[model samples]
Target: MDPSDEGSSGKRSDGQIPVPAPVMEKKKKMMKTKMVRFTQAQINNCIAYKEEEMPDYDSMPSIIEILSDDLANCPQDYIDELKTIDDSREEDKTFWIKMQNEIRDEREWILRQCFTKGYAEYEVDIDDDDDEDNKVPARVAAPPGRRRFRNGVAVKKNLSLSGGGSVRKI
Candidate 1:
């Protein structure tokens, strides 16, 4: 029997070695959690359909821009639909509350999916093995050229590619 094996008398009892503590442990949940409250900045970021906000989905800036522009030139029927939605909000407080809740969900989703800072700055990552063929080139400094943001999709850039030699750029 090894002398060090004993706690005091150098006699082993269980014949098992002691296990060390883990390097990393799971984090504990926060007790005093702050709830997310809606603000004007957040409301401004909302992606609304027509004048009313689009609840429960991503409200992309492009989507909002398209809706606004379309409303400006949209037919009376389309405008009526928008007004109906607004009227529903005015008539039913519960409906408005539901919409507001949906918008909150959308806001959270947007913050999760898109940039937390509101705007995303896309930049290519450079690796050690970068070369002429495999090089991570910088984005084009020139303007995107004639590609206006229409209805959240690129209007100038053709996305359809169906032919012998298919070519589509967005």
Candidate 2:
């Protein structure tokens, strides 16, 4: 009898084999949730739009009135912020106009960045001759008595070819 199989097999009177303890797996660490916030540029864009559409005048429209028609899809927080700004500086046309221009500049800068990045990343396949200036290629008809399918039945190419120069129906 082999010494290695001494305890492994039930040959011995005791009939016992030592079993190794199972290793415990380490638990994965949970990742923290990231906070979502709008960029300064996006905020500025909203403010600028408000100023351009509704200028200062006697009995001018209220902040909510000005933004009502425009901000149908905008977030509640954004609309609230605009209203707060307007209420805080009531009848201060100069301050509002200055703020509007600053916001407008920032918004424009963000738009320019988006356009620049998009244009830079865009690529054209110059080597590919498949599509020439978006024009569709003319379809070529099959030769006489050379139908793609045999006996009106579809089959893969390179398998077999119909010998007769006439189409047959089963």
Candidate 3:
């Protein structure tokens, strides 16, 4: 009888340590996305439509610039508003949020004449490996999702992609 095998209760008897078998991990749920490669003609058509029919927005004013101008002209605009209601009351926690909502409202108004009404399903990424300047991007960035006060507590809200907001909703 092998001395290594003596007094064994189905345990390893070879005097060598047994390494545990690797555990099969549960398959993780990955984001489901289908890549649709547009033909050169399709790409050209899109570019052509924007170039031909769409009014040029190259010199269009941005919200950042607009707001900056507004605040710059009157640095105490926010403070002034706060003062009129209650400046002495601790602090206005929802002031910034109210400003954010105003911005959202303005964005929605500006985008009322959008090409598409709702969100887009497909997100395109340019796979070009070139490290050059002025490279073209296919499609990207859904930035919507704002903090809205619900019972004075901030809650998430969704905005449409047409309003330059996110595709996901809350």
Q: TM-scores of all models?
A: 0.18, 0.23, 0.16
Q: Tens digits of per-residue lDDT for model 1 on 1-170?
A: 44445454433457555444458976543343333444546545554433464453222233334578678777878777766665564446666678778867766665654446554223343433334347667888867676554454432444567524333445
Model 2, span 1-170: residue lDDT tens: 34466554435434444444467887544444443444666545544565455454547666788768889989999999988876765557667777878977866665665566531122233433333446877899878885564456543345347643433354
User: Model 1 has how many clashing residue pairs?
Assistant: 0
Best by lDDT: 2
Worst 10 residues of 1 by lDDT: 56-65
For model 3 the local lDDT of residue 167 reads: 36
Candidate 3: the clashing residue pairs are 144-165, 144-166
**Regions of model 1 farther than 4 Å from truth:** 1-91, 115-170
Q: Write the per-residue lDDT of candidate 3 for residues 1-170, one digit (tens) a residue.
A: 45454444445646655545668998443444465544556434443542123333444454445566565666576746644544323233355456656755644543442335322233445433332445678787656885353454433345755554333334
Please give the lDDT score at residue 155 for candidate 1. 29
Which segments of candidate 2 are over 4 A away from where they belong?
1-52, 58-91, 119-170
lDDT of each: 0.53, 0.59, 0.47
**TM-score-based ranking:** 2, 1, 3
Report how far residue 136 has shifted in candidate 2, in Å. 63
